[model samples]
Structures are given as structure tokens and as C-alpha cells.
Target: MKTTSITHRLADLGGAKWDLHTAARDRSDRGEDIVEMTIGEPDVALPEPLARAATRAIEAGRTQYSNGRGENGLRDALAESYSARRGRCFERDNVLCFPGTQTALYAVMQGVAETGDEVLVGDPLYATYEGVIRATGADMVPVPLKAEHGFRMQADDIAQRITERTRAILLNTPHNPTGAILRPAELEAIAEIALKHDLWLISDEVYEDLVFEGNSFTSPLTLEQIADRTIAVSSISKSHAAPGMRSGWAIGPRGFMDALLPVSETMLFGNQPFIADVTEEAVRAGSTVADGMRQRFAKRAQYLADRLEAETVLRVHRPEAGMFALVDVSPLGMDCDAFAWALLENAGVAVMPGSSFGAHLQNWVRLALTVEDAAMTKAVDRISEFARSVAVAAQ
Candidate 1:
């Protein structure tokens, strides 16, 4: 059989998931016990109610297909939560359920952007957003967010990048790799740019609940005007430590959502019915479980930050919220990739290179502070020792 020709866009999308695999392989080859702080995978147990809900769903034979949009119960639950948090009235028709936020984000980009169109992405982003935009043959225009700015994207920076080809702006609150939470004023500025340029705002709020230090999470959906142009994407993966559940939803204007339904129909046909059934239970009872997980992550983040403060070589950009610390190791003067590899080999520590987030930050590394406090403390000690040795070698 003749092989089908792969598109050029697919060529640009490979190796996105290689960081974790590389860390795992390096640890195995060295016969070392690695404390993984690379991926944002929470090392917490799944909420007890999630398992019960899943068991009941499976017993009820909900293993079929759900509506392409989503089951009404799950949609209602999501909408209710949206209303409670953002004070926005969302209807079941305004939501679409998918396997996870990844699929939901891809579908939204596919729906709104055409080939060669441009998406304004904040640098040091979630990493996968580039792949999603590239897969659609759209230009990923990265606007850098400096560590000096707490990795927050300013509105003026976004405005300078806007052009006729720009179709959307991707926003991640309590952003991954940095934990940069866009405050209300910063979000307002971005919203104004979106409104002025007529750009769609793709708001990724998966980490909204995991905020720390009493930082408030402000959503674009809170603005009545932007609600029509905003696509608010969230998932159960991070909030309840239920990544196994693989359920998420996109809440936005009905018109924009309708555009994405065709993409969903072509890709997933419909979301998993069983997962949707369990998702209803999660959404309804998520308040307590989600809050508990946030508190645990807050404790872990604090422990890691406190340890980082004692290290002379690395500087941690302590975020007011979220599960990560964007650590700058420029004082040691090694590229992030090399630093990460050396740490893995010598200290048995695994971390993500800031280069994974964007090209401008070659000297920065990202540490996921979501692991258990004990594991994180040990990892910090390993990193500090590694930094000291590097310092001595330089002299």
C-alpha cells in the first residue's frame, strides 16, 4: 500500500512529550532514583468520590457514547460552577465536553484559525500550545514574558504583535512553567486588546483553583462583553488530581462553540459517556475536593520556595499562585537543558528546561512543586549541592 504523505505541519509538532521520557531513560541508565519535577503530574491520590462516581457510572452501563456537545448534566454542573466563580451565566448550549483540555484547546484553535493565520502566544507558555497551533498550520507568534515581570504578559506587548493575520490570543492563568497569574488589571488590559483587535481569547484556566498565597484567579468570562469572544477551557485533571478521568469542557459563546463542534465531531465523534457521567459527580462535589488539593499543593510550593531561598546559584521567581517556580540559574551560567541533564546525572533530580517553554529563556529551569513535600525537600537539597559543585568547578 502506498503511504499517505504527511503534512509539513505535523513535522513541526514532534518531541513535545520527550522531556519526561528523556528524564525517565536517563535515570534508568544511571541506576539512580530520580525525583521527577519535570511534568505537572500531581503526585496526589485521586479524590475518593471520583472513584465511587466512576464505579457507579460503569455499573449503570454508561460506557456508551454521549452527545457531541456533552451530557446536559455535566454541562449544567460546569455552567453552575462558572456562574458561582465568575458570576457569568452559562447555559448547557455554551459548553462542549472533550476527553481533556488538550483536545478542547486543539478543537478551539482549529475552529477559529485557518492555515497561515497567526496566534499571539505568551512566551514561557504551557509548551503544548505551540504544537496545537502548529498542527493547525497557524503561525505561533510568541510574545516573551520576562522573569523580571513575574513572567506576566503585558497588554501593550500583545498589542504590538497584533496584525491582520492574528486570529486569537491564548491566555493561561496560574500559567504552567511559571505559575504567572494574570491579575484583574492585567487581564483587563489584554481583554481591551482582544476587544480592540477583534481577537478571540482562548483562556486556559486548568490551574485556576491551585492558586497559592491568597492570589485571586480572574477569568475573562467575568466580563460580559468578552464572554461572547472568549473560550474558557478547564479540566478535572489538575483540580481534583483526576488526570486518569480525562474529562474537560470548553465554556464560551454558543456561536464560537458551534464552530468547534464540527472539529469535535470529526476528531472524537463524541466524548466518553462513562467519563461524562463521572464528570457530573466531580463538578457537583468538586468544591471541597478541589480546595483540599489546592491546600496540599500550596504547602508543597511553600516548602520548595523556602528551600530555593537558601540557594545562592539559582533564583526562584516566587509566584503568588500555582504549582511551579520559574527558577533562573544564570548565576551558574549554564544552559537550562545542560543544567537539567547534569542535575539528572549527578543529583538524580529531573526538571524541565525553560527552553521547553520558549526560546528566549535558555538559562532558566522550571521545577514542579506539586510532588510530596518530603520528595520536594530532598530534590531541593540535591539541586543546592549540585549548584555548589558547579560553582567550585568554575573557580
Candidate 2:
């Protein structure tokens, strides 16, 4: 019997990061002490009020299917929150909720882009973006973010890559892997380019609430001119530490959102009612919980940066906003994949290789700040030792 072949688009999709994660888990299951700093998951729990709200909704029989767009009250709450943040009038019609931010992003891509179109993406982006774009039958045009520019995506670079077939620009602030936050000027520049090119701007602001001191988050929707073309996606998964709840949303112009509703409905008939309840409570409670998490993450980021700087040969690019540090490990005379896998196997510490993010990052590795202080310290010590060993071997 012959089996059906998998689609080419998905064949080469997942990154080595998942393989490392599985290896780490296997090591732990076998009683090996492994320090995991690979995945960008917060070592925090859901806020008490939000969790209670979810429980209440479940007990109250709010488990039935909700409106395809989302729960009415939840959509209103998200719209109000975004309206306050973006300084614009956003109603329920402008917001669409989903089980996860990933789905929301997919819906936006599917809504705005068609087969054979091109979407510009910043290099060293969140790993999933590439797969999501390709899965939509669209090609991802990478716009490199140089380390010299502090990994910030430049508008001029994006402009140089735009073609008649380009349909959208995927922007992530407080970006994953590098933790580079886009400044207001940069946002303005990109928004202008998008406006001039008549391209949709898909802004992934999932890390918006995770910014540190002196760095801030800006949304393209804040620009009045591009508001109609921007789809700002975010969630409580990272900020509220409720990844398991799978609650997220996309806010955009009414017309675009109306177009997205059918796609969202076909993909996820509706969000889980209990999760929607939790998300509504979380949103209405405002950013207090997220603010607290941000403060903690800032301190942890500094701690890890200091450790890597002092002990390892890796050149650490300390994050300004998100919970990750992109460290260049070229000095160790090994590419990122080799360095990461060898360190995990020999030192029992796991981190994501830069190659997992993109080709331009082959010499770097990403350290997540989600590990606890004690575990992070241990991991750093092991990483330092591994770096020293590599340096000696290269001599």
C-alpha cells in the first residue's frame, strides 16, 4: 500500500528547536539533570482572577459554541482595550479572537495574501512565520535585520524588496529571538512604505507588554493613515502566562475584519468559551499583571546577559524588550547548530540555535529568559564551560 505524500510546503517546516526540546525532555525523563533554555515560555502562572473567571464560565455552562467572530463581550472588551492603546475608535467589528495568536496570524495572512504573492518578513523572526506564509501558498521575502542596526528592521530595506506581487509586510515588535523593539520612527517609516506600496501590515505585537525600561511598544494602528491596512495581533499567552488557555486576537479595520470572519469561522468555528471568558477578564483587568511580569523579566534578562558576558566568549546582545538574548557564538569556532547540540549533549543544557531563526543567524544562539534564576544561573555556568572548551579545542 502506498501512503499519501505530505505537501512540500510543510515538509521542511519545523525547526531544530523542537527536536532539541524533545531531547531535553527525554534526558529529563531518563533522570538526567537538564537545564532547558530553548523554548520562549514564561515560567509564570495565570493570574488568580483570570483563572477564576475561566472556572466560573466553565461551571456556568459557558462551554457552548460562541459567535464565530468571538464571544460578544470578549470582543467588545478587546476592542475597548485596543482603542485605548491605539487612540482610535475600535468596535467589536474591528476585532476577531481565536484559540491562539498563531491562528489569528494565519487568518490575517490568508485574508490579505493569495497564492504566488510575496510577503516581506524580517530575518531572524519567530520561526513559525516562514512556515505560515509558505503554507498560505505565498512566498516569504526575507528583509535582513543587521546586528549593526541593533537588529531593527529598516524601512529602506523593506522598500528595496517590494514588488508588484508583494501583498503584505509582517512586523514583530519586541521581536522574538533578538528582542529588538521597533521605535516609533521605524514604525512610521515602515507604515509609510506599506501605505505607499498599498500593502497590508501584519503587526505581531505579542511581546508588546514584555518591554523593558527605556524601551517601549508601538503599534502601526496608531498611525492614522495606515490604520485601515494594519492588522495588529496579540495575546495574553505571554503577558498573562496563560499559553495553555490559547486566547488571542487580531484587531484591524472593520472591512478587513469582516473579510477575516469567514476564514476564522472555517478554521476555528469559534474560540473556547471558557478561554474567551478568561481573556475578557484578563483584558479588562488592564496591564497591571503584565507590567509586573515585565519588571521580573527585565531583571532576569539582565541577570542572564551579565552571566553570559562575564563567563562566555559569546557576544551577547542584551534584549531591550522581549525575554530572549541573541548571542553570537562565532568566537567558539562552531556554527550555532553544532554548538547548541554539542552543549545540550555534553553539558545537559538546551538553547535554540540561531540557524533555527534564519540563515543570517547561523553563528548565533538564542537564550530564553523564561528559566528561573537558579536554573538560569546553572545553565549559564554550563554554557560558559562549553564555550571555553570549544575555544581551547579551536586553539
Candidate 3:
């Protein structure tokens, strides 16, 4: 008998080696406190009402598996929530609930992407998109988002890259690693490409409510022409500050739900009823849950931007809106990976390398302002010290 190894498609996914667990363990072993600004973990508490709802559901013995499409009431509530919150309308039939947006994204990838099909992704994108695409045995074609363009993907560049092999376009609004939101004209252009290419438009709008600076999020689902081709993925993770709840939904056309349900069912039995019930309650509570979270993240974003501006070696892209700030560290003469490691080991501040998002950006780094204020401040202070030292040495 021959010994078998893991599959080939999973071989080249570099970022999945996120050793935060090992890093945390090493820090504990060294008895040194670390300030983490790498992971996008919300430091805020889940809405009080959501917590109460969860507690009530548990008390009411709502801890069983529910419909794969979600409980009827919860599904209806999600439709209403999206219309009122995101300005996107969909029938209850359009929504498919999942344990988390990650699952929803993965399901979409598996549903539409075939072996060796190509996925057009914005470079320096959310790191997970690469892994998900590869796991589906699809090729990831990274269309680099330029720093000069505020890290937003240009429609012309995306159009140039689309090939006959392309199956879908992956989009993340209020983009991770760079808090760049796509402008309306750019969005309309993308809609045109999707329509022209007859490709699936899978958008991760989990940060939909986190917009600021008067830059509202634009969802692909809102476009009438592109609506059928667009699969919208969102979660309570960022908006409700409820990552632990693991509640999310995918909304698209009725055919999408029909296709998605089988994949979701075969992989996950169903969305957790208790958590879904709580999320339903939170959504029904309307803007109170989502907008309040955005206001809190806005304050934190400003705090991080102020600190980065004081640093000499980092070229901070003060995000218009979102819970992350992108800093170009090319001036420090260090690649993103090396700088990230040095920040972790020397300064005790951990952040994500822009290279992890995609290949074109190896000199930029991302700081998640979602950490608690005191710790975030400490992380910024450490970053400032490192940047100052680099600047002085260059002089």
C-alpha cells in the first residue's frame, strides 16, 4: 500500500499557514504580552438584544438543526433586513442561510467553480479567497488593485484579464487589508463586464454596514441586470460584532438558492437554529444593530489613522471607511513578510502582510483596528517606534 498525501490544489496556498495560534503560544511561553493587529477580530460586545435573544432561544430549547434555507421566519427577516439596511431587495426564496460567511463563500465557489476554471480576484484581496478558489481546484487570476487607486480594482484592468476560462469574479466591498470601497461608476462598469462575460459575480459584503466618510457600500445584488448573476455573501460577524455566533446568509436569484442548498446541505446539515434565531432577532431590530456597530468602528478607524500619520516610514492610506488601515512600508526597504515578522518578534506587534492578500503587493501591510482601544494604541506605538528607527537609519 502507498501512503497518500494531501491534494495538489491545496499545495500552493501560502497564507493558510497563518500561525497566529503558534505565535500566541510562543508569546505565552516567553511570558511576553503581544499586541495583535493582524486578525480582524471585533473587540466590541455583541448587541445586548442579540445576546438576550440567544439566551432566550437556548432557554426555549431552540438548539436543534433548522431548515437548510433557514427557518421561514428568519429567512423573511433577512430579506427585510437587507432591503432596509443595504438597499437591496430579495424575496425569502433568494436567501440561503449558513453557519458563517466563510461557509457561504466556500459554497458559492464549490457550486460555480469547476476544476481548472479561473476566478478573477483583486490582488491584495482578502487572503481566504485564494484558498477557497484553490480548494475548488480553480485557478486564481489576481487583478492587482493599485495603491495609487486607493487599492480599488480598476474595471479596465479586470476586463483585460477576463478569459473564456473565467467562471466568476470575487469582490469584497469595504475591502479587507485595504478599506477601499468601489465607487459607483466603477461598480456600474464591473456590472457591464459581468453582463458581457456572462460570469457569476460573487461579492463578499460582510462589511456592508462599516462604511464611513460618506462612502456607502454598493452591493452587486442591487443591480437589476446583474442581480441574477450576483451571489451576495454577508454575515453578522462584522456588522453585529458577532463572529462567535457564526451566522450568515447568501442571497441571489431563486436558481442560486436551489443550487446552493444542495451544496450547503451535503456539507453542513443546516444553519444552527439557536444562532439563526438570535440573528433574526438582531436583523428585525433593524439599523440599531448594524449602524451602531459602524459608528463604533469609525471611531476606532480614526484612532488608528491618527497614529499611522505620526509615523515617518509608513505611508498610510487613511481608509475612507472600514475597520482596517493599509500602510505602504516600501519606504522601510523591507518586504511585507519580513516587516510583519520583525514587527511581531522585535516590536511585539503583529499585523498581516499585504503579500498575503496577493502577489503584486509585497511592501504593504494591513492593521485591523478591530482590536480593543488600549491594545490597538500600544500596537500603534510599537509600529511608530519601528518606523522611526527605520527613518533615522535611512537618514
Candidate 4:
């Protein structure tokens, strides 16, 4: 049997991107003491209101096939949420629901790009981004996100790389791996370029709810001039600590929705009604647990940065939002891969090498901030001690 090139390009459905983390899990399953910081998943349980909503929907016989786009309630709820937040007049017609942010992004890529087309994405982006773009037969053009800019994509850099083949710009805010949120001015400049080039702006905003106290999350869709060309995808996975629910949606121009409805149906007709009901509750009532997560993750990030700066050769780049922080390990004279693997093998600490995200992160290691307070304290202590030992060995 012949297979499509997508399978080869997907790299075993993107498992290759997480090989280190997978190996750590394998060891942990064998009863090793690995403090797994390799994944950015929320540690909290699903909010009670959402859980109750799903159960009630199931008990009330809501387990039927939904429409091609999505259930009206979830769509309407999402529309309302976006409208209120962005100050834009969105309707159900502008919403298309998928199981999660991953699927929504895949569909958007398929809609805006294809073979011979180039989609401009920031380097060291979310790990699965490479697969989704490649799966659409589009080349992902890496726009270097400079560490000096706190890893945020600069509009000038984006403009410099705009070739005629460029068809779309894929953006992740409160970005994965780095957790740097784009400022409104930067977003406005980028949006203007997208308009000037007549390219689609695909914004991945899944972590919008987890922003730290002093920072705010901005979306290109909020720029009124770019709304017609901008498509934003999000979910309750992080906000409600409900990743398993797999309820997500995209809000974009009506024309894009009109064209993408078939693509959405072709993949899967629609999501489960029970899940839709749960999602509707999540979007409408909002997540009470997100505030708590904001406090914990932000606290851990500061603690990680302060401890590393005070006690070791390592340096931490604290995140404005999201569940991960990057630690600079170049001072230890080891690449991030060597540093991460050695930390796991000798110190029982499992963190992701920054290179796994992309080349720009080659000198850094990213660690999840979702562990309990005591567990996180112990992990940081181990990392500090490991960093000192590595530095001494180099000395």
C-alpha cells in the first residue's frame, strides 16, 4: 500500500518533537524518580461547573450528531465571548468549532496555504506547528524571535522576510516555549504588514486566559482593520483545566468560515453534543480555576528566576503567561540537549531542551511550572545544584 507524504512529514504524528520527554516518561513508568517538567499541561482538575455540565448533557440524551460547523450554543457562546473581549460584532456564522486548538490550526492552515505557499511563523514556536504547516503542504518560513525582544516577533523582521510566496502568518501569543506575549503596538505593526501583503493572519490564542497580573494578551483580530483578514483559534483546555474535553473553535471572516465548513465536515462532521454543552458552560461562565493557576504559575516563574540568578550559573527567562519557563544553560558549557539529558539521568529532573522547539532555543532548557509548590522547590534546587556541578567540571 502506498502512503501519502504527510505521514513522513508528520514525523510519526510529531512524536519526534518530544523524544526526550517520551524517554523520561518511559523511565518514570518504570518507577524512576523523574520530576517531569517536559510538558506544559495544567495540573489542575476540570472546573466543577464544566464537569457537571458534561454529565448533565449526557444524562439528558445530548449524545447525538451535531451540525457541520458546530452546535449553536457553543458557537453562540464563543461568538459572545470574542465579541465582548475584542469589541467586535461577531456572530455564530463567524465561528467554527473543532475538538481542540490543534485541529482548528490545521484547518486554518489548510484554508489559507498549500503547496508552494509559505506561511511565516516565529522560530521556537509550539512544537506541533511544524507538522500542521507541513501537513498542509506549505513551507513554514521561520522568523527569528529574538531573545532581546523577550522572544516576541518583531514587525520589521516579519516584513523583511515577506516573499511573494508567503500566504499567511501564524502567530502564537503568550507563546509556547518562551511564553512571551506580543505587545499591542507590535501586533498593530504586524497586522499592517499582513494587510499590505494581503496575507491571512492566523492567530493561535489558546493561552489567553492564563496571562500574569501585569501583562495582557492581544490578538490581531482586535485590530479592527485586520479583523476581516484575521482568524483566531482558542479553547478551554488551559483556561478551565479541561484539555481532555477537547472543545475548541475558530472565529474568522464569514468567507473563510463558508469555505472551511466542508473541510471541517470532511475531517469530522462535528463534535459530541455532550462536549459542546460542557464547552458552552466553559465559555459563558468562564473558569474560576484560571485565576488560581495564574497565581501559582507566575509565582513559580519568579521563584525559578530569582533562585537561578542568586545561586547558579544558569539564568531564567521568566514568562509573562503560560505554563513554561526557559533556563539559559550556555553558561554551563553544555548545549541544551546535553544539559537536559544529563539533568534527567543524574539529577532525576526532566526538562525539555530548547532546541526541541527550534534552533533559536539551542542554548536553553524549558521546564514546566505546573508542579506542586514543594515539588517545584525541590526540582529548582536540583537544577541549581546540577548547573553548579556542570560549571565546575568546565572550570
- Highest lDDT model number: 4
Report the error of model 2 at residue 117, Å: 0.4
Backbone clashes under 3 angstroms, per model: 0, 0, 0, 0
Give lDDT tens digits, candidate 4, residues 1-395: 88888877776555777888999999999999889899878888987778888889999999999998999998999889889999889999999999999999989889999889999999988988888899988888999999999999999999999999999999999799898999999998999899899999999999999999999988888898988899999998999999998888899999999999999999998889999999998888888999999999999999999999999978899899999999989888889999999999989999999888887999999999999999899998899898888788878
TM-score of each: 0.95, 0.96, 0.92, 0.98
The residue pairs that clash in candidate 2, if any, are none
Report lDDT per candidate: 0.82, 0.86, 0.81, 0.91
Backbone clash pairs in model 3 (N, Cα, C under 3 Å; residues 3+ apart or in different chains), count: 0
Looking at model 4, the pairs that clash are none
TM-score leader: 4
Query: Which ranges of candidate 3 are over 4 A from the true structure?
Result: 1-6, 12-16, 85-89, 287-293
Regions of candidate 4 where Cα sits further than 4 Å from its true position: none
Task: Give me the overall lDDT of model 2.
Answer: 0.86
Which ten-residue region of model 1 has the weakest summed lDDT? 3-12
